[model samples]
Target: MNQTQLNRMKDGLGFIAALDQSGGSSPKALARYGIKEDSWKDEDEMFDLMHAMRTRMIKSPSFNADRILAAILFEQTMDRTIDGLYTADYLWEKEGIVPILKVDKGLAPLEDGVQLMKPIPDLQKTLDHAKERHIFGTKMRSVIKEANPEGIKKIVDQQFEIGKQIAAAGLVPILEPEVDIRIPDKEKAEELLLKDIEENLKKLPADTKLMFKLSIPTKPGFYSELMKDPHIVRVVALSGGYSREEANQMLSQNSGLIASFSRALSEGLNVAQSEEEFDQTLADSIESIYQASIK
Candidate 1:
C-alpha cells in the first residue's frame, strides 16, 4: 500500500470523479457526450470511443488533484493508457489524484426493492490486476429503491462482505449502497440504511477503515454520526440521478459528505467542443463540485 496515497484519501478535501460507467451505461454516457449509438458499429469501437472521452477528461487542466481527490475507473479504462502511461499511473503520478477501480460487474435485477451486485467470479484476480496497475482502492455499488428492511440489510451485508475481501487484498474499498433519491420513502430508506451500516461497522476489525459512496440524504446531516466513526475513512455522496445543480445544493447542506458524481461531473462536456471550450466547461463543473464538497 502507498501510505502517502492512503493519507491523502483519508484527509483529501475534494470530491471523487466517477469515470466508471460500464457496458450497460456507456451508450447513455456517450449520448450525453454527443456520440450516438450508431457512431460505433461494435463493442470494441464503442469502448474505444468511451476511452477517448475519458482521455479527454483526464487530460483536462482542471481534472487534477487540486479539486479532485480521486477517480473511480472502469476495469477496461484501467487496462488502457492516457498519454502513454497506464490510466491509474497517469492519475496518481502525473495528476496527484488517487485512483480507485470499480470492481462490480453491474447490478442484478431489482429484487425485494433493491438491486445487489451480481456475483464477481475470480474477484481476487481483478484485485491483483488493480494493484499491479497502481490503484489505491476499489468501489462497488448496489441500489436501494424502497425502505424494506430485509432488502436494505441484504445490500449492506453484500457490500461489507465484498469490502472485507478488498481490504484483505490490501486495497481500501468504497462501499456504495446508494439509496434512490426519487423514491417516495427516500428518507425512511436512508434511516434504515444508516442503521444497517452502523451495525456492520461494529463488526469490522479495529484497523479496517472503509469509505462510503451514498446518495445525498434527504435530511441534512443524516450521516454525521457515520462520518465520525473510526472505521469510516470518508463519506461521499453520489448524484443518484440528480442534476448537477440539484446534487450540489443537497450536498452543500451536509457538512462532511462530499461528491462522487459521474454524470454531474461530466455535465457540460461534449465531444464536439473545442479544447479551450471543453477545458473551461470542465473547470466550471469542478469548481462547483469542489465548493459543494468543502461546504
Candidate 2:
C-alpha cells in the first residue's frame, strides 16, 4: 500500500462511535432519555432535542480522542453548528476525530419482502455535500437475518455497487451487511457472507479502498483472510444489540476486528448524568472498547 493508504488504514484503528440513527431508531433512542418524539409536535422542536443529544455525543471525545478514530453522523447532525463550529468541523478540527456520514435511507422491502436499504437515488449529490463539509468517509447498512443465498448475494452485490460509487466520489465506504446475531446458523451465515464479500471484492479495481462494518463472528479470527487485503482499510465490528461488556468480550477474541458501535457505545450514556459523569462514562466506554478492538 502507498503511504497515504497505509496512514488511512492505521488511522482507522480503535473505536468508531456511530451516532447516526435514523427514523424510528432516532426518536426511540431519544425517548430513553425522556425526550419523546411524540411530544415534540414539530420537526423543529424534535431537531432541537436531537441537536442537544448530538452535542453531548460530540463532547464525549473532547477530552480524549485517543480511543476514537471517527464518528458516523446522521445528515441532520452533519450541518448543525456547535459553539460556532460545524459538527464535522468540531470533531475533526477540535478533537482530531474523523467524521463519517451515514448515507443510506432506511430499509425497504425487496424480493420475498426481505428488507434492504433503498438505493440512495442521489448518492453523488450526497457525496458532493459531504465533500463540502470535509467529511472523511461514508457508511451504509443492510441486514441479513437468514442464510438465504439469493438474498445474501443481492445484498452483497448492491452494497459493493454503491460502495464503488462512494469510492469513485473519493470517500471510503463502510459496507455493512449485518447478519442478525439471533440467526441459528450463524457460522454458516458468516461463511457465506465472507464468500459473497470476497467474490465481489475480487472484481473491483485493484486500488479500491473500503471498510467493512461487520457483526461479531461466532468464531474468533473469522476475518483473518480479510485482514490480509490491503485495500480493506478496516474491519469494524458492530455490537448488534449486544451489551457493552458482551460486545467488548467478543471483540477481544477477534484478531483484527475493531468496533463501530452505536447502541453498545451509548449503553450507559444518559441525559440525567452530570456533565463530568457523562464525560467519564463515555471515556470509560471508549477505553474498554479500544482495548478490546486492538486485542
Candidate 3:
C-alpha cells in the first residue's frame, strides 16, 4: 500500500520480551573490577570470561538495540555511560533499524509523576543527538493513567514538540500505547482508552503519523475493531513466546507487520547455546506478513 493510503499505523501487534534488561549493568567480578590497575592483561581470558558471563544478556538479540534506542527520549544516562551512547548510536545507523521503546503513562511528561522534569530538554536533546547519529525511529509506549483528559493532552503535546523534529529527519515518531484496541465483550476498555487517545492526540502536525501496538489473541475481530478507531494508523500483532510456526500462522491471517524478538533466540547466533532454534522466527514472521500483504 502507498504511504498515504497505508494506515498511519506501522506497529506490529506486540513486543516479545523475556526479562527486564534495565535491572543493572552486565555483571563483572571484583577481580576484574580492578581498582585502576590490575592490568589483568590476561585480557584475553577476561574477555572470554566476560563474553561467557554476559552471553545470556546479549543473546536475547533485541535487548541491546532496544535499550540504546530508548536514549532517544528518556533519561538513560547510565545506559549511555556503560555502553558509550555514541558508539551504540552509530551502529543502528548502518543497519537502518529504529528500535521501539515502550513507556507506561507514568513516564509521560503531561502527568503528575513528571513534576521533577524541568523544561524536559533532556529527552529532546537525546532525540536530537540520536538524529544526528543517524537513527530513524523515535518510538514510545503509551498508557492512560490519568482520569483528566487535559493531562493526557499535555503528555502527547509535549511528546510532539520533542519528537516532531526527529520526524523531519525521516525518523517516525511511534506512539505505542499499550492497550487492547479490541475488547470483545468488554467495550468499556476500548472506549476509555480511545477517549484518552482522542483528547490527547489533538493538535498534531499534518506530517505526524501515529500507530498503536497491541497484543494478540484478543477478541476475534478485535484488531479490525481497533482499526475502526480513527486515531490508530495501523496495528501490529505481537507474539509472546509463541513459536515461529504459531506466530506465522497468526500473521498469515492479518495484513500488518510481524515483529519478533528474533535476536533473543541465541540459537541462530550460535554463541553460548547449542544450535537448537535459529533466528528463523524473524524470517518466518516477515515472510508470513509479506505473503499475506499481497492481495
Model 2 stretches astray by more than 4 angstroms: 1-13, 61-63, 110-114
Compose the digit string of candidate 1's lDDT tens values, residues 174-271: 99999988889999999999999999999999989789999999999999988889988899999999999999999999999999999999998899
- Across 1-295, the per-residue lDDT of candidate 3 in tens digits comes to 1242132124323332211122111122313222122533554544444434233333334333322212222223112322344422423433223333322224434353121112434555665555454444445544434333454445445555554554555555555444322324334444444455555556555656555444443334445655544544554444434554555566555544433333122212323333233234333433443443321
**Ranked by lDDT, top first:** 1, 2, 3
Judged by lDDT against the true structure, how good is candidate 1? 0.94
Question: TM-score: which candidate is best?
Answer: 1
RMSD, candidate 1, Å: 0.7
lDDT of each: 0.94, 0.83, 0.39
Q: Is candidate 2 or candidate 3 better by TM-score?
A: 2
Candidate 2 per-residue lDDT, tens place, 264-285, comes to 8777777888988888887888
Best by lDDT: 1
On the 0 to 100 scale, the lDDT of residue 67 in model 3 is 24
C-alpha TM-scores of all predictions: 0.99, 0.93, 0.48
- RMSD in Å for all candidates: 0.7, 2.2, 9.4
Candidate 1 residue 284 C-alpha distance from true site, Å: 0.3
Backbone-clash count (model 2) = 0
